[model samples]
Target: MVKLSLCAIVKDEEACIGRCLDSVKEVVDEIVILDTGSRDRTVEIARDYGAQIEHYQWNDDFAAARNAALQYVTGDWVLVLDADEILHPEIVPQLQEAIASDRHLAINLVRQEIGAKQSPYSLVSRLFRPLPGIQFSRPYHALIDDSVTEFMAQQPDRWDIGYLSSVAIVHDGYRPEAIAARDKLSRIRKAMERYLSEHPDDAYTCSKLGALYVQNGEIEAGLKLLRKGLKQEKHLDRLLRYELHYHAGIALSKQQKVGKAKSHYEAAIALNILPALKIGAYNNLGNLYMQTGDLTGAIAAYERVWQIDPNLPIAHFNLGLALKEKGKLNEAIAAYHHAIELDPTYAEAYQNIAVILLKNGKVFESLDHFRKAIALYERRDSPAGSELRSTLKEMGFKI
Candidate 1:
């Protein structure tokens, strides 16, 4: 029987701590918390869950705090978790089996962030054996498995780190409501500023900071920083290079620098980034070509997205728009149907298809679709629905 220890570091996590603990309390042998000066009921809630709590002084170093927590874990295997995440109940058996296996040294757990697909999701190394040499590094966004890699480098046979398909953790720390509650965007900017000041040549940090600025609506500042980071492309890893170009492309588009923006989008595509990001870049390029009156280029770009991911509604909708503009009526209608298949409640798609049908003398069927779109839109009180209804009434069609 292998004992598993659940370890976490938290501060002011009152709103989420209980939920985190309740989800995992059934599986672990012991629970430990390292409180970094929490001024809330976090400690109290942790205590209720039989978690051994110890206070650690805040040193602006995540790795230090995490390493300190490692000292208290007595179990044969350790599982790292945060206050805003939960171990999925479905994964409990997989976790237990992993620890019981004597062959594995480390386990890469799946972290499914809500609302995002797992493309290029680097398996977060959260489960590991408590070896003497293993510890964490980095001041922020701490590298939890750094010491494991170093220890494995000498004895390659001992490097049995692998991913588990059965277990997945749901993390909600990046939720919009959570971000708004903690002023997370403001904190990210401040942290990035400090990180960049100390490590000016770190292109990945520059990429993150640049993207942060763009998200905060500082478009020019974001573009400037991203462009500067792009100059050190050799220093950037593959994903960060993709992200830098992607952020800069978005900012350029906002500034109406279409040609420059298109180049950056194309560059991100060339980098072979995450599949979701690649699809997004293609869609942006497609939209850019459409806006610039290059119908042929737009069609090609949208075709790339369709080939990559036919399930994405936006890609189909955009393809429909381009096909319609190209006067390919049957293809346009098929594309719109594809969009509707992916998103059955898409009123705009219904509206568009209805208009096309009405123009093609399919009056009764077209009127039925128009009514369906209007019903859904009116339920939501959308302006587009009202305007569409007004147009139908003016055309002498009874609704």
Candidate 2:
């Protein structure tokens, strides 16, 4: 029975820290939190969970703060987690069982970006043994030292790191406006500045920095770094290529290089990597065609997704929109209906169908759909329902 130390470093995470700690409290032996000047109630919430808290000074060095937190771990194995991350309740026993078994030294629990369902973006080193030499490296995006990397590489077969299927780390890092796209870019730039200063020729850092630039709306600079990284690195990671192509496509599209953007998007789809990545590529293609006033092309791209996954409500909704734009009102209505069938709680599809009904002079039917949409949206606590309700009222529909 191997004991576990769940370690984390956080700052100003009052909105979500309690949720994170609560999720994994029962699974670990000790909870160690390193706070870096949080003015919010993050520290108080952590205290409520009986977490051992230590104040770490703000130094723009993540690895340093994390290493300091590691010193408090009494467990043989350490489990690292971010402030906004939580493990799914069902997989708790599976994780404990894995740690107890004599199969592997470390386990790579899939880090899933929330709202994306089961699509895991990265295999973060979340669980590992607390060996003396297994020190972390890199100041910003630091990972375990080269010795661990080399050890893993040497015994690729025997030095096993099993990926637990039933387990997942759901990260809600993108939930708030403070940590959204713009803010993400700002943090990435700071991290990139430190990383690039030390390792100028590193492909991973270059690719990541390029992606940050793209998110920040620096199209030319982003393209320059991506292209340079692709050209300079001989054997680029295929996974990295998927992200590079996706971001590069967005940059090209922003630059009005529609043809080039489409080419990159096509290349991404051709990779046949993760299904989420495939869906993203197809969505981008639909968007590109929508921007170009090629309604038929947009419909075709979205429709392709339906063939691959008919139950995907977003695909059906997007297809309906494209069809409606092309004046295929009957087909569009059918598409929206399919979307609603796929997801009974899909407010957007109901609203879209209502709009189409109103356009076709079916005022009574439109009112009914709008009511349904409003009901679903309100139940889900969405602001969009207010506008929908107002529209219904203005149209003389009895609420």
Q: Top model by lDDT, which number?
A: 1
Question: Given candidate 1, what's the lDDT at residue 245?
Answer: 86
Tell me the deviation in Å of residue 127 in model 1: 5.3
Local accuracy by lDDT, each model? 0.82, 0.78
Write out the backbone clash pairs for model 1: none
Compose the digit string of candidate 1's lDDT tens values, residues 1-399.
Answer: 888899999999999999999988988999999999999999999999999999899877777899999999999999899999899899887777777777788887867565332121234678888789888765565655658767888888755776676436878877666778888777667766887788886676677788788877899888888988999888665666887887888889888899999999999889854454476677888889999999999999888887876776777888899999999988998999998898787788888889899999999999999998998898877887888889999999988
| Stretches of candidate 1 exceeding 4 Å from the true structure | 1-71, 74-178, 272-277, 293-312, 328-347, 361-399
What is the Cα-based lDDT of residue 242 in candidate 1? Answer: 82
Cα lDDT tens digits for candidate 2, 205-287 = 77778877886787788888888777754476565677677777878988899999999888777774545446667888898
* Per-prediction TM-score: 0.71, 0.78
- Model 2 CA deviation exceeding 4 Å by range: 97-105, 114-123, 132-148, 154-157, 165-167, 180-184, 289-313, 322-348, 368-399
TM-score, cand. 2 vs. native: 0.78
Clashing residue pairs in all predictions, respectively, total 0, 0
